[model samples]
Target: MSFIGIDLGTSSVKAVLVDDRQRVLATAARELTITRPAPLWSEQAPADWVAATLETLRRLKDTAPEAFRRCAGIGLSGQMHGAVLLDARDEPLRPCILWNDGRATAECAEIETGEPASRAITGNIAMPGFTAPKLLWVRKHEPDIFRRTRKVLLPKAYLRLVLTGDAIEEMSDASGTLWLDTGRRDWSDRMLAATGLDRSHMPALVEGSQAAGRMRPELARELGFDAPPLFAGGAGDNAAGAVGLGAVDPGSSFLSLGTSGVLWRTTAGFEPRAGSAVHAFCHALPGRWHQMSVHLSAAASLSWWSSMSGQSEAALLGELGGQIDRPSPVIFTPYLSGERTPHNDPQLRAGFLGLGHDTDRKAMTRAVLEGVAFAFRDGKEALEDGTSPIGEAMAIGGGARSDTWLAILADVLNLPLRRYRQAEAGAAFGAARLARLACTGESPEAVCAPPSGEADIFRPHPDRAAAYAERHALWRRAAEVSHALR
Candidate 1:
């Protein structure tokens, strides 16, 4: 049988069809837009998600009709921490408050003050990007909507509601809401109360590899399926990507260089280092957890530079070739959208230091690349403190396409970086694996095995590593300066 995996990303909705042997049969995608009504506020209409998902599925089906018809299970992965508030009739109360929205910064403190055990309970510091804080922001500013709110669902759960008419959530995504008692993998009564909400506002929880519900009959027929397919309780985008890479065992790690950068390492149990802004959340599979360091801008910094310079990302990097001989004379801080890991300061902004008369676009490009690598190094240090070392990491995401960047990252972090076959498939491919496990009742080890082909490895050069070590220290000092400026 074939399985379908759908990912609801910030920029687009993507679907992939995979056969029983875990080979991707077909792929499709539909772009999505974000609305910024005010500064630091991001929103997206719930209807738009539904529309994009349906269109993407249709496109996937068209590409491989036979495989699509034999689909046995459907798995979902989506952007985490979005608050999709629903009313009595289960209709969205307003556009979803996105994960990157910073409008609820003040509410984060309110939660910590109201729930003294919040950090201990949620295993995280109060962050405006979490769902609970967004709800608190709404309660204080948009009281009428808050009063009308009946249920809160993460982005994928909202899509799950539309597909199955069930309000079910899985562990990995729910762990980001700041409502779950992450250690126990369940909703926290105290956490909900602190935000003036309760258990009723939460959905039934399930493990990511379990079956949540079957698709609605009408929806199934509309999608051209012969039967209502079993829906697997999938995962948050990061965790889903881990499953796709088979980084499920403790100490197994990967770094994602998407619009945002993340250094993720799987663990055997809950490990919270909230003081360092490290996110300790449940993994996609049972009995596993993960710690991650996030930098809000990774490839995004390159995107911004590309737009400003009127040059494509590929063109800008092409000028530098596959590697750089030494660190750029100029140092850059990639705080374009503020930062998260190691420094949860959203007010921090990016800057370039030591610009000379000879500083050209190529130098700036190299500095941008090195800046992001330095940020990952910061994350690596934070996770390494008082925990097992991350000896090596697999690289994934759009930025992983850059061999030069990967080489730079290897030198900066001083850890080998591996790029696996089919790395481009990412979270959607992992979601398909989760669907396979749920449908076949197979072990995660068997279903979520890493790709079979030999991986391309990026090793650090000794001389460059020593040079970057000194530059990284200077970069840390510069980051401290940025913090002071903020």
Candidate 2:
């Protein structure tokens, strides 16, 4: 039997078909647009997501009708922290407020004032990217819509509701909304009181691998399949990526370099960082939690630099490859779109420090790579608390495609970086693995195994590690200066 995994991302909806042995059979994607009618506000029509999902599934059916018909189960993974409000009739009241939209900063501030109690109750600090603040924003500004709201769901959960008609969310995705009791794996009553919402407005919570429902007969027919079992409640994109990369075990970790960059570490129990810098979320793996450090601009920064300079990422890396032997004094702060972990400041901006006449494009490029590494290190230190050192971390996404960047990351992290054989498909592949486990009643390890590839291990050189440590201190100082100036 084959399994289908659907990743409903911020920019597109992607569907992948994988065989029982975990080999991808067919893939399809449909891009969707985010509308910004006003500054700092981002929205997407829920109908648009449904339409794209349908079209993407249609493409998958067209690609291999026989394989599509043999699909045994379907799983979903999507962007986290987006708010999708539904009316009593289950119709969306308005366009979803996306994860990137920052209009709820004021509400975030209000929630933070009660941080001590909030953290005790929700196991997280309020952030504009979370769902509660966005919900409050809707409640305060769009009262009529708020009154009509019957269900509050995340991006993927909304899609899951449409797919399964169950109106439920998984614990992994719930952890991102700042409304979940991370320790208990349930919605926080304190958060509900603070937000002036009731528990009834939220969807029932399920474990990541639990079967939510069967595919709607209509959707099944559309995809040329019988009613396949639907595992609608999978996980947030990051957690799903971890599942994809086989980073489900404690001490297993991975770095994702997608639109956002993240350093994910799986742990057995809840280990909340004293400071709310790192996000502690429920992992897709049963009874496990993951701590994450996020960089808002990871691959995005590289993309911007490459696009502005009219250089392909490969070309830029090729140019910088020559300068790796020579150290440059320049240091870049990868806060182009502000920052997430370590420093939760959105007003902060990217900057270049130690630049001089001798600084060249190659040096600048190196700084960009190291800067992101430094940010990751900052988050690592905050989350580590001298508890457990990450033994090895798998690398995925576009940034991992570069050996030089991997070297920089390995040196800065001072840990072995293992490049996955199947790169850039972490989320989709993970969803398929989860679907397999759900359908077959097998352990994740039995269903998912690390792919065999040429291993490129980067060990830290003592000298470079020391140099990076020094540069990290300077980077922290620069962040303080930048924040003050703002």
Candidate 3:
């Protein structure tokens, strides 16, 4: 049988069709737009998500009719920490506040002060990206909408509601809401109270790998389905990507160079870092936990450079690859959208130091790449220095497409990195695996198997490692001083 995996990503909603053998049969994507009504605020209309899903599924049906008809289950993965408020009729009260929105900085500080137990329970630093702070921002700034909010759901859960008429919030995604107790894999009463929210505003929780609900029969038939497919409790995009990359086993880890970069490792039990930058959250599968160190911008810095320079990524990188003979004298800090991980400060801004008359577009490009690499090194060091030590990691996402960047990353962290076959399929492929487990009762180990084959390997260069080590140290000291000045 075939299964469908729908991933509600920030830029688009992607749907993948996979057979029982875990081979992707067909895929579809619909682009989405993020609206910024004000600086540091990101919003997306919930109705657009529903429309995107339907359009994507329709495309899947039209493109691969046989695979679509044989579909046995559905799974969902989405951008985490988004707040979708619903009124009494289950209609969205307003556009969702996304994971990257930084307007809630003051609200995050409020949460840290009012809810001292937050870190102990959620196992996360109170960053403005989390849902609790966004809610607090709404409560303080838009009280009327806060009062009308009868339900709070993440982006994928809102899509799940439209598909199955059920309000399902999976564990892995909910863990990022700052309202869940990561150790218990459930919502914390105290956390809810801290946000002036209650159980009534929350959805029924489900394990990330378990079945959430079945598709409504009428809706299934209208979509030209042969049966009402079982809907699985899919994970957050990072965990889903881990499953796709076969990083479920303890100690298995990956470094994703997406819009926001993350270094995550799987563990057998919860390991909360009381005052560290590490984030402890439940894994997609039950009985397992994962820790993450996040950097708010990774490939995004490159995107910014490309846009500002009017150079395509390929052109910029092509120019950049030729400059390996020497390191750029400039040092850049990639705090363009503020930062998380080691420095939980949102007001921090990005800057470049040591620019001279000779500095050109190519030097600036290399500096931008080097800056993100250093930020990633910061996270990797935080994780390795903490309870979890990462020896190696699978490299995935848009930046992973750059051999030069990945090589730079390898030396910066001095860690071996592997790229897997079908690495670009990412979260949607893993969501499809979750769908198989939910419907066919297949073990995660069997369904979410490690990469059937290896594609590439990147190892550190000793001389470059030493050079980057010195530069990285300088970056940390300079960043501290810059943050202080900010």
Candidate 4:
């Protein structure tokens, strides 16, 4: 039998077909646009996501008809924390307020100040990226839509409702909404009261692997097959990525370098970090939790550098390789999009300190790489304080494709970095693995055999590690100065 896994990302929706033995047969992808109507506001039509998902599946069916027909189950993973409101008739009330949209900062502050009360309900402080704050934004600015709302679902849950006629949310995705009790794994009545939203408007909470419902017969027929068993409840992207990296056990961690970067580790039980340096949320794995620290501008910073200089990434890396004659004295702060971990300071701006005419493009490139590594190190230190010590981390994502950057991360983090083979394929593969386990009664471990590929392991150089320690102190001071100015 075969299984299908879909990753509904911010920029695109990707579908992968895999057999019971965990071998991928074929893949399909469709990109969607994120519409920005104003500054600090990002939105996307829910209909766009639905259309893209259907087109992707149709393309997959044409490419692998046999695999598509033999598919026994389907799984979904999606971007986290977007708020989608629907009217009483299940029609979208407005474009979804995306995760990166910071228009709800004022509302977030209000909820944060409401503190102990907010904590009592959601087990999390209010943040602009969460659903509750976006809901409040609607109530204050677009009260008409808020008034007509019958339910609020995150991005993937909204798509699932359209596909399967089920209005249920997985715990992993719900935990990011600031409307769920992280400790209890359920909707927070206190939060509902605080947000002035009735609990009835929320979907029922289900475990990530639970079967929410089967695919609608019409949807199945449209794709040229009978309705397949659909696993409505899956996970947020980060949680799904964690499963992809096999970070299901305590102390196992992964570093992701996508448009944003993150350092995440899985744990057996819920453990919220004090002061909110790291976000603690439910994992896709049952009865487990994960802690994550995010850097809003990780790979994006590198991409920006390439675009500004009109140089390809490989060419830039080659130039930087020639500059290894000596360590560059420049320090960069990777806060172009604001920071999420350790600092949690959204007002801070990116900067290049200690720059001189002598500082060549190589030095600038090296600084960009080092800056992201420093941010990751900060997160790793915070997670260490709250949970088990991180001895090593598996590197995945577009940035991990660079050996030079991986070496920088290893040196900065002072740990061994292991690059997984299917770095970019993490979430979709993990979703497929989850579906296989759910359908065939196979253990996740049994299904995810050790990846077979050459892995470059970077060990920390003691001298480089010491150099980074000293530079990190200066970076922190510079960041504080920048924050104060803002």
Best by TM-score: 1
| Model 1 residue-pair collision total | 0
Candidate 2: regions farther than 4 A off: 112-116, 274-276, 354-360
The Cα error of candidate 2 at residue 431, in Å, is 0.8
Per residue, candidate 3 scores C-alpha lDDT tens digits across 1-486 of 999999998889999998877777888999899898988888999889999999999999998898898899999999999999999999998999998899998887788899888898888888889999999999998999999999999999999999999999888899999999999988899999999999999999988778999999999999999999999999999999998988999999999998889999998899876366678889989899998888888898898888988999999999875425445788888998888888887778888887999888888888888889898888877787835468889999878988888888888888999987687888998898898888878688887787867568989988888998888888777687669766
How many pairs collide in each candidate, listed in order? Answer: 0, 1, 0, 0
The regions of model 4 sitting more than 4 angstroms off are 322-327, 448-454
76-124, model 2: which lDDT tens digit per residue?
A: 8998999998999988999999877777889987776754477666556
Candidate 1 lDDT = 0.92
What lDDT does each candidate get? Answer: 0.92, 0.81, 0.88, 0.80
Pick by lDDT: which candidate is best? 1
TM-score of every model versus the real structure: 0.98, 0.93, 0.97, 0.94
Error of 2 at 17 (Å): 1.0
lDDT of 4 by residue, 1-486 (tens): 888889998878988888866777888999888887986678999999999988888887888898897787888899888999999989999999988777787897777676456654554556777889998899999999999999999999988898889898888999888888887898888777677887899998887766776788877876776546567367888787877777878767888887788898887777777365578888886788888887878887897788987998788888875314224588888887667777765566788889887878888898888888888888888778744678888888788888888888887788898986665687777777777666766666676554567877888888877878778888778777668765
Q: Which ten residues in a row have the lowest lDDT in candidate 3?
A: 319-328
